[model samples]
Target: MKSAMMEREGFAALVLRLRSEGISDINLLTAVEQTPRSRFVAHHLAEHAYSSRTIPIECGSFLEGADLAVRLLHRLRIGAGQRVLEIGTGSGFMTAVLGRIVERVISVERYKTLVEEAQTRLDQFSIRNVILRQGDGSNGLPGEGTFDRIIATAAFPAIPKTFTEQLVHNGILMCPVMVDDERCVMVRLTRTGSRFEREDLFEVPYLPLTPHIASYL
Candidate 1:
């Protein structure tokens, strides 16, 4: 019989799969496995929450690969004692992960219901480092000036120009840009002597960048 130890081994196996998908950071993997992803997703889909794939949540929003998100953030060099701003808080999974590693996080979402639900889920986990808001992410979080890091989970046309202005000098901005009708491109923007540079990564398809809250962000 496969005992609990074997089941734990299985969980490790899933983590290894994350590694294969370009998530090479050890701490990010641990956080991905440690966070109760199942708890954040719908109850009906909880069983597969740890399966290293995206799970559909309410409001048409989806929980992306926590492994990928963690890896991207790590590559961006996010660390303790810095303020970070996230544009999308779908399930609050990434928010929780960032909360653990960063000094503080201000995550913006457009859908009221999605924001409320994610806030409730994250609050249950006692993740106090993240601040949730309902707003237009495309415009960027106004009056929340000068973040040490800015990350957007939604797919956008390009890194919003406003985001570059909001980032502190020497800061980094990460987002998935739309390459065509459906393909997603991971865009990494790092400040260099007052300018920003971008690196495009693999394609991913996520919910659109809801410049306008449309009942589904």
Candidate 2:
């Protein structure tokens, strides 16, 4: 077992790696420093928690590594008091980061198990700014209204119309879009009046965004 000192050093090293990857946002680095990746990772993988790599969670969903998390947050450029919508709660690590930086986060996950687990993790941190729901994230959260920023942790072949429609003018929607059957790219879409402009940021591997809820399994 790694000592507390060792764990801290590990995370510190991870931060250096994140900086090397071009994630220079101090706020994001601070959030990562405050949040312990082990708490959101699988028990079996706890020892590797501080490593900058994705870890599988329940229902085949994966918690994005510190690098991707920082990159996404960097692209969204979320600010305090901004209403944000997160499309995949997964292990709730990113949700926690969003909660620390934004006014509120409405996170939707298709897996009931993941929703429940994520809620539990966030509650442990006393993070009260998150609203967790089990539903089809591809549809976006309608009753909650539009958001200043929308981030989908899953990959979609194309940005869903509902997500674009739910964004206020000038709002940003960041998600991984499928480039082909086996590859995906990170895309940022800024709403401008009745239309949205797309910018491809980087290539990444993420689980496919699906419409069906995995409630029964």
- RMSD after CA superposition, every candidate: 2.9, 1.6
Candidate 1 per-residue C-alpha lDDT over 52-137 given as tens digits, one digit per residue, 9 for 90 to 100? 47878767778876456555666778777989999988888888888877889999988888889888877787878889998888
TM-score, cand. 2 vs. native: 0.93
Worst 10 residues of 2 by lDDT: 1-10
Off by over 4 Å in 2: 1-3
Top-TM-score structure, candidate number: 2
State the lDDT of candidate 2 residue by residue for 1-217, as single tens digits.
4656756987788878877877777877777777788888767887777765788777887877766777778889988889999988888888998898899899998888988888998889898988998888888887788999999988998888888889999899998999999999999999999988999998887878878788574
RMSD of candidate 2 to true structure, Å: 1.6
TM values, all candidates: 0.87, 0.93
Candidate 1's TM-score reads 0.87
Model 1 spans > 4 angstroms off: 1-11, 20-26, 214-217
Best by lDDT: 2
Candidates in order have lDDT scores of: 0.76, 0.85
